[model samples]
Target: MSNYSYPKLFLFCIGGTGSRVLKALTFLMAAGVDIKASQIIPIIIDPDRANGDVTRTIEILNKYRDVRSKLEFDRNKFFNAEFQTLNSLDVATGEGKEVGSTTAEGFRFGIDGTKEGRFKDFIAFDKLQGANRALLSALFTEENLDAELKAGFKGNPHMGSVVLNRFSESEDFNFFASRFSQNDRVFIVSSIFGGTGAAGFPLLVKNIRSPRTSLRNPEWIKNARLGAITVKPYFGVKQVDDSKINSGTFISKTKAALEYYHSNITGNNSLNALYYLGDTLTLDYNYNEGEMGQKNMAHLIEFLGAMAVIDFMGLEDHSLVTEDSKAINPIYKEYGLNGDVKTVTVKNLGRQTRNRVFKPLTQYTYSYLYWSRNLSSFPSNQPWTKGFDDSFLTSQFFDDDLRQFNRRYEEWLNEMGLNERGLKLFRLDMGHGLLHQVIEGIKHRKKGLFAKERWSFSEFEGYLNSVDGKVRATALPALFMELFYMATEKIFDDRIPNSN
Candidate 1:
């Protein structure tokens, strides 16, 4: 029996990632991944996805019924595909009911973002004068949100309650028995660059193959995903990175996401795998005129990733972009100006870089008392050099600048008393095992690195030997082992803050 469930694979291309994701989907078809007109599910979850341009784009394509569909077909004849409706933010009662407001209105962008929470809590706090937990309560459980969306259902109509419900509700995603056989490799193409990537990816994976499942094969969730990230370089499209700012507020949340999947699964670690692919000099893109290239490139990567699912069990990891850095500007850097990029750039490069770049500057940075007095001073969360580790970076690229950053990050962690477990949450970064699995698996399958653009087996025969003895891979175990020590030291020093 074939491992495929219905012989079709579903690649949910959510949010800002839709363009590239669709491109990757098409690539799979050309490579002979059995895809059909009715099998693939094209899901768009970005707030931007619902905007006029996107709607118009899809409409034009659908209306013509001839300019060729965006996505691709699979290698298996049984695999089929279809375009799904893009989800929208429920504005009516989703927010208005929970937060009794002066102006009862809702827009998908959600009030320009900062005081983010559920409608219930937004109401309780604004209209009801509720407590912090009460506000937090308005958020939905993670599991509910995951289940509703993954089931191919658009979320709650109003307030986009499912998104809110995800945060408050502790319930999470659960992975279970294979409605398919063990051989079917599951591939998810995602951007580790934005909100969905930061919040949704982990939840999706957890639900699919959660550590806690009821199935007989405790291994059901094991090694299923084989992580793949579409890392995009700094396009310089926007001056401030509001999306990244939003993500910044969720640092620990991001850490938790990484922790759930990044672990030491040595042999045949199945589901818990991931890789990255990036395009750096997007600098060539003109903000106003480069729309064509951006859209085209997006489709390309997405299709390639989808093809990887049908053809093999690996990912394309790269260094041009960062899963940690959204490759965008920081919004927090925008408050002082008239929102002019030129002016902002001057002020930031000359004055703000020191305080803003590396913050949590002083012990009193967060003092509400002092904060009230110095309302003009910008206080940022301390800089955490996430994803890039010390031992590994030193061994690989050996960049002195990076080593310095990692050193600073380690000091911060030491101060925070981040234990081994807390540290382990970060170990799933770009390293040997991740790259090895993808490369080795591809070799075993006799597939070209780029479907035919070179990269043969013999060329990669000694690829592993080229690096400084897999420095990054060696670092994982070390971090796991030493994490406990730092955690214990914090316990001894009693500096560990209560993680509420």
Candidate 2:
């Protein structure tokens, strides 16, 4: 048995950006980014059942879980991490069978009466007393209250707070609390400007830190290691007819949310650690409040937000909160870059950030490119591909599941590259010779005819040949990942100059 015992990390992804960032984190984890936790449970909270971003993220998480389960845990660095839905964990613990049919279906918790109900009906405006009715009227416009609740709160936290308050009584919440162990930790990801995120973050934290008496293991849940990333406004949407969302209101909404957080969140020491991140260079997305049209391009800030989760998991126990009864300072963090360049490269990132991500991302990108482009043409005598027959290569496991995942991974990186403060890690346009295109900012100085053939399959094969002894015990995913890591590092030294 492996010496390493796995711990669980429960993640609450609150809204649209929350889902997108979680998707980015999933990709990074697949690339062997160290999250430090053994298992991750992602819980997505959004009213829009047909939300494009949320749906895509849930699909990715399901695929990740399926792939990881097939590759048995062997202390390998690649695909070593495990992902479980809250329902799976509950079922494992003998709490109950899952309510939803699939893992993606299990990811969401629907808000009662939101689908076809109006906000006024949701809050029972006619049933409230005069002062309460007046308060509600003052807080929400008729347009806001009369608006359909199925889509979302439309960037209004007033409606979200009322609707999301019911989450504590949810069956999923009970299951989550039942499975909560003393060693488990919780992390939240949300955008401060949007409705579901803005209202959900604080409420969710509050409940976790002060779980109700009815919840299983409430005491343990209260003391769990908690961390959160509150994303500020990082993108704008184009104005469209009858749209309630506006780019201009992002700052104001963020400011309002920050003020509330200061008093209720930071002032009260509600969280053990808090991470803040936003980009001044925001991307302009097509305007859509909800549904399939609301899909936004991946942004650099979302990547940074994902990084914060990894960083938080690495923090020493009690570093963010005091072990004793006395109050301790909460850890506060903000993302920064070394340069002000619009097109961000490796050098633009902080040394620590670059060091953590660069090598693994590069290696994974190389591995993916090789599999997609060169694997078929490479010599069959290669040890790694020796046992692989045409039927095996064409199997649904590889041709469908793994192939689709690789394509999504490439698309994820491409979208990030195209977004503002772009992470130009790979040249997205190239179809072949992808390793040379790995480092976008660096200049390659060719040494000779062989140098012109740098990053070729033969060179990659030669590097694999050199590492025969190191990979003697490694199998499939790890063997493949280890080979790519070794090959990429060698090529970096031989071909790319000034690379750190």
Task: Give the winner by lDDT.
Answer: 2
Q: Model 1: what TM-score?
A: 0.35
- Report the lDDT tens digits of candidate 2 across residue range 22-80: 99898888777777786888888888777889988888877776666545433334455
Residue-level lDDT for 323 in candidate 1: 23
lDDT of each: 0.29, 0.76
Per-residue alpha-carbon lDDT of model 1 for 333-364, expressed as tens digits? 01122232311121222233222211111111
Q: In model 2, where is the ten-residue run with the lowest total lDDT?
A: 94-103
Show model 1 residue runs off by greater than 4 Å. Answer: 1-6, 27-39, 47-185, 211-227, 230-234, 240-272, 284-307, 310-500
> How many clashes (backbone atoms < 3 Å, residues ≥3 apart in a chain or on different chains) does model 1 have?
54
Evaluate model 2: give its lDDT.
0.76
